[model samples]
Target: MSLSLVLTLLGAIFLLLLFRYILTPLFLSPLAHIPAAHPTSVFTPLWISYHRRGGSQALPAITRAHSLYGPIIRLGPHELSVRSQSAIHKVYIEKGGFAKPKFWADEFMSYGVRNMVSMQGGIGSKEHAGRKRDLGNVYAKSVLLGSGVLSDVAARVLRGMDEVLERIVGEEDNADAEKTGSGVMEVYNFNGAVNADIASSYIYGTDGRTNFVGDVAKRNEYFEHHGTWLKGKHGHAESQKWLEEFGVQLCGPGVSALRDEEKGGADAVVYKQLHARGLRGNDMASETLDHFIAGAEAPRTTLTYLQWELSRNPTRQARLRTELRTLPLDPTTDIPNLKALDALPFLDAVLMETLRLYTPTPGPQHRITPPEGTTIHGIFIPGSTRISASLAILHHNAEVFPEPGVWRPERWGGGDKERESLEEMRKWFWVFSKGSRGCIGKDFTVIVMKLIVAKMYSKYETEVMEDGNMEQEDKFLAGPVGERLVLRFRAVK
Candidate 1:
């Protein structure tokens, strides 16, 4: 053939390739039927990745996109952001066809091995299920409230809080003069320490307990290292090394802490079950580390906001104290029965309201569509597509939560419609996500949350002194934007 003829044929082939690769994905593909977050999202990831790196702005940005574009929106060439109830139910519940995205392994495998939270591949799911089944009773609502193991841990925490109270009220003689005996206590650190101590207690037993509440400085340093590891600011490996060192500290020399062959703490309780049913060493450590890693930041974020809200409302604080007094725990020393605390109407309202307003992990809970494809809200999402639903978006949904931004505990108490209202709220209450992969520690976390709230508000009246960065952070595991809260505690008369 002549050179001119060859050039003409080449040009025609290039045109065909453009139509197949670009034009089809932009205008003809199944995802093309859905609204695009940005026009380029039809064929590229630039739009979504840009926003993902947009920091805290990412939540409001995606939230606005759903508000403007309806429930299903294409965020990338292969990514779908679904917010509709029908879509959420299909992707996360009824169909349950989507698997966690690939990043979960890298995100959670920091403990030198993968735990159930990071489990992947074929048998990995079964392995996770097996771990949950074997250990499920340990965190069950009935068992947790009744378990001597948790009760002992709670008793320890309550005792620690009592000490913390003394320092907060300037009653302790050896209290760090600079750190305590003042009304202005950094409860951000206090909450974190309490959570860390409890988590460590369960993971490492009473002997290896971390007394963060007792020593605020130690918790400050521990969490500083912990946060560095999470944000990967300096570098992930360096930060992770620090965290792993801390992990070893939590588990070392305490496997037999509750000796006499009467091991009762979680370290012994879970280890025995896991070993008898097959699993040891790193497997044991990974799960324990999962608890440490998963449990720490949640309570920190939660208590800060709950206190912030209460500080803004003095009457609510007084009423909450009245409700807490009904628990019957001695204001100075005694611990309340967990069951009675859970049954408190006002305490339940405060916790449920906080979680709804400030869902801890408000970022995307992502899942990939199955090989056979799936339909969300009547829109057919092709197989192998990346899809997700944001709890932040779901929680603020106007229809489900009227005046979504307002913090009104009364909304949770609807008398005759109380059961009906709570059932409806649960549908929109995506703080912990839903479906098979829902947080196993939801009840566990709630128990701890209610317990602490019950204990703290029972005697102390908190005043928010300096709450500069009160905004919630924009990361996957986020707290207030300020990341700090300074408050004054006055003993309730």
Candidate 2:
């Protein structure tokens, strides 16, 4: 056959298969019994994919579908959304048979490189679990609380805040002759500095640290470079094809350039130190690096939101500051040793409330059912079906959280009813997710948040700058939609 004839035949075959396998099922199959976000959902995955690509709107759209369809909504011929908490636990925690959905693996895994967070399938799961087991002891609460990690992070945060304050004070002094109203100073970059510093320290240890706070220019450059890769647009087609064939090892040129740059820079020094401390090779070093980089973004964004919340509610901020003041304040001191700080009920309440109201990355935890049929939310679901549960929808359920959208930390305290409500919330708190696939760095994240918030409140007064936006983009992870935040800081003696 002529080449042109062969090409024409191939195109015809592709169209036929696309209509038969993709179009008919999405539109006309039995699974179509389930409601779709749009009329075209029955015929195409494009509706959902477009929203997913839109970033933050993805979860809200899924929640809207669940609201209309109830706990189980048929999304595609093979896909379903489970909105109930019971269903979430049943599908994700109890039925150990499901594997991560292909969409996540395709988007997240680096050139077929399977870290625990992005690994899929039975074989991948086993490999990831084994790696996690080896690293579990290091991340335990006792170790996190004891290793002085939080204290060191707190110190770095304080240092960064001091620098901001000094610069503000200097400006105020210099501008005394031109005297403006209130000498405002915006601190747009501190949260990012604190998280990047804290997260890097934990992963690489203090002796082998990167000055995320001190090296603003380099850090910003790294973020811009990495942002392109995260969008999956920098050589995405080539990377995905390579991943499909070779797995994670086939690092695309862009990714390879990044790895090479880091390996030659100060980050490489930290990687070496980690190896010297008996951690070696790609699994430990690579996974730690990926976690540190990805993890820093959300918590920093969360802290910025928390600070904004505190600023808006000055009375609450004052209460937290009062609580913070009662704790010991020696620069050499560790917070865990300060029982008063550790026991601050309102602070804890505020943190929990922030977590619920703004779940970082409120997207669904996607999974594929086992070969054997399973029951979720008491309904039977067949194997090979795609299923997911959204944290945002679950957290906002009015039944569990009264006045769900309001920020009410007091509700976390009151009495038995309040305590019970809080307990239930904790159970359904999919912030760090649940089960074996849960975030391995949960403890580290918590420590970082607590330390940063405590230190900031302890040493300075914060107010929201006019440009700050608490609204987050609901992508795979929630972050400031435009990746921008600004706040004013004034030193308090």
Which ranges of candidate 1 are over 4 A from the true structure?
1-6, 9-13, 54-57, 95-97, 121-124, 171-181, 262-268, 330-333, 414-420
C-alpha displacement of 354 in model 1, angstroms? Answer: 0.5
Pick the TM-score winner: 1
Q: Could you give candidate 2's per-residue lDDT for residues 321-423 as a string of tens digits?
A: 8877777765464343533454577778888788888887688888888777677655566788888888888888888888889888777772224453667
Instruction: List per-prediction Cα lDDT, in the order shown.
Output: 0.76, 0.64
Per-residue lDDT over 1-493 for candidate 1, one digit per residue giving the tens place of the 0 to 100 score: 9999999999999999899879999877888799988878887888778887734336777788888899899888898888888888877776333577777545777556877778653223576567677675766678778776776787778778867676657744444322534756767877877877776776577777788877766777778877776765566577678777776676664556545346333544544455556656677767777787677788789888999999999988888888888777634437788888788877788888899899888878777887778777666778879888888899898887888998887778722244326778887888878777777787878988887887788878988778887888888778887787877888877
TM-score of each: 0.92, 0.79
Kindly give the number of clashing pairs for every candidate: 2, 9
